[model samples]
Target: MAGILILYATIEGHTARVAERIAKGLRDKGYRVDLHRADPAGASLDLAGYEGVIVGASVHYGRHPGHLRALLRKHRAALAARRSAFFSVSLSARHKPAAAQRYVRKFLRRAGWQPQQAQTFAGALPYSKYPAWKRLLMLAFVGLAGGDTDMSRDYEYTDWDGVDRFADAFARPLDAI
Candidate 1:
């Protein structure tokens, strides 16, 4: 069986958890899986050996991490050639679905990445991890969205069932490619 690669770019670690869950789900389904981070430390890696790829990233302040953008640009050809899925993690998806969809569309347009499948997953808010300024900003945003405003704890909105469904859908096309 050809291996699947799960690449992720995360800020506060939720996206990374999502990537790991996807990898584990695929592995449970009998596919070989490789989980890799797209941070600067992982810049040397490529998707040349994988039969299928799944790329995931989190959004912060309406933007994805710069390293993830570079990674996509660098491996665009290889990524486009394979059976691939791209998932975006954003708190906006949890609060406002339309805006999140627009964000994903804009991201894809800017990155020039047209994957076989794309999804938007709700992200988490790690209030404890945020600095004072960011915490205040996020609290305001969350409050405006009618979401949790508690800074003493974190909130996760990821839908695992949706992720499992996505993984299953992505896996179905691997054999054909």
Candidate 2:
């Protein structure tokens, strides 16, 4: 079976965990998977070997990482030729679905690569991982947005079941191939 490639960019680790879950879900369905971090300085990967590809990244300050965008642009043709999907992780996905969708739209527009499937997943607020200033900034932002403001503990908003469903949907087409 041709492998599926799971490429991701994470900040604060939640997106990485999401990627891992997707990889696990695909593997459970008996698909070979190759998981790799999307690095800006790293050498380009050959997307030809994979039967399908799933790209995921988290939003910070309202944008997905620039490196991931550059990577997508660099390999846009190869990505378009294969079965592919893009998933975005953001806090807005939980509270502001339209905003999350906008982010995804803006990202794909800038990258110039539209995949077969796209989704938005809620990310976490890891207060402990942020520095003092960022933590305060995030706290204020969340407060204004009517989200979790408790700094004493972290909060995760990702819907794992939704993620599983996305993986299943993406895999079905590949299974048919």
Candidate 3:
């Protein structure tokens, strides 16, 4: 089986959910899947033998985890050699249709790595999960973007079906290869 590596950097678990769904979808399709977070202290999962890789990250203030960026920089060559995909989760993805896909350009430039497939998934506003500073920061940011500002509960906008389809698409190219 072609092992698939799914790496993510999450703040309030939306990106984690996306990673889980993608991993499960790939596994159900008969591929071995590895799930990991791009934290420096996390295990250095062996990506050498994987048949493919999918890197996911959620944006806060238009940036991803520096830890993930480091991994991408270190594994640039290896990732480029494999069947690879990149998915970025952000509130901006929930913007108007014309503005929704706006993050790819900045993300690509910041990550300095590109995959065969790239996707943008809507993220969440986990006000309840945030501390006071985070909550206020998000509120201000959300306000500027015409997003919900209530800090009572969390809000998620990820499209699950879209995630599954993306996984299938990634699997499609691997199957072809």
Candidate 4:
């Protein structure tokens, strides 16, 4: 069976959870899915083994994880030659459409990825999961964006249905490839 590789980089785990859902959705359709977090500093894994590749990452301070960027650059040629998809996760995606779009564009350009399908999904603010400093910083940023700032709980802004649809979009292309 052909394998589908999902590599993600997440902070506070929201993107990780999304990756899991996407993997499950793909697996449900009988694709052999291999889910793993992108290693920033390590030996570059050969992407030749996977028939299709999906790369996901969350934004922090207006940038993606540095190591993932390097990896993407290293494999950009091979990835562009195959069926590939990219997803960016961010809290700004929920409230700041312009910022989210700009970030997505920036990431795509920086990563040298020209995926047939790309998605910018809203991420979450897990106050309970954050440390004191992060909670305050995120709450302030979110509050400015007109979002709930209560630090006692978490807030999720991702649209799972949209995520499912994106995964489905890649499914057929993956199978065809």
lDDT of each: 0.86, 0.92, 0.83, 0.86
Instruction: Mark the regions of model 2 whose C-alpha exceeds 4 Å error after superposition.
Output: none
lDDT of 3 by residue, 1-177 (tens): 788999888878889999999999999989989898877564454678798999999876666667777668777878878998899888888874344455665666666777899888988888988889988988888898898877787899989999999999999877754
Lowest lDDT block of 10, candidate 1? 39-48
TM-score for candidate 1 = 0.92
Question: What C-alpha lDDT does candidate 1 achieve relative to the native structure?
Answer: 0.86
Top-scoring candidate (lDDT): 2
- Return the top candidate by TM-score: 2
TM values, all candidates: 0.92, 0.96, 0.89, 0.95
- Clash count for candidate 3 is 0
Model 3 weakest 10-residue run by lDDT: 96-105
Please provide, for model 2 over 98-166, each residue's C-alpha lDDT reduced to its tens digit, 9 standing for 90 to 100. 999999999999999989999999999999999999999999989999999989999998999999999
Q: lDDT per residue, candidate 1, 1-177, as tens digits?
A: 679999888877889899989998889988989998886564866677799989898888787766777678777888788898889999888988888888778777777789999899998988999889989999998999999998989999889999999999999877554
Model 3 TM-score is 0.89
Model 1 residue 68 CA deviation (Å) reads: 1.3
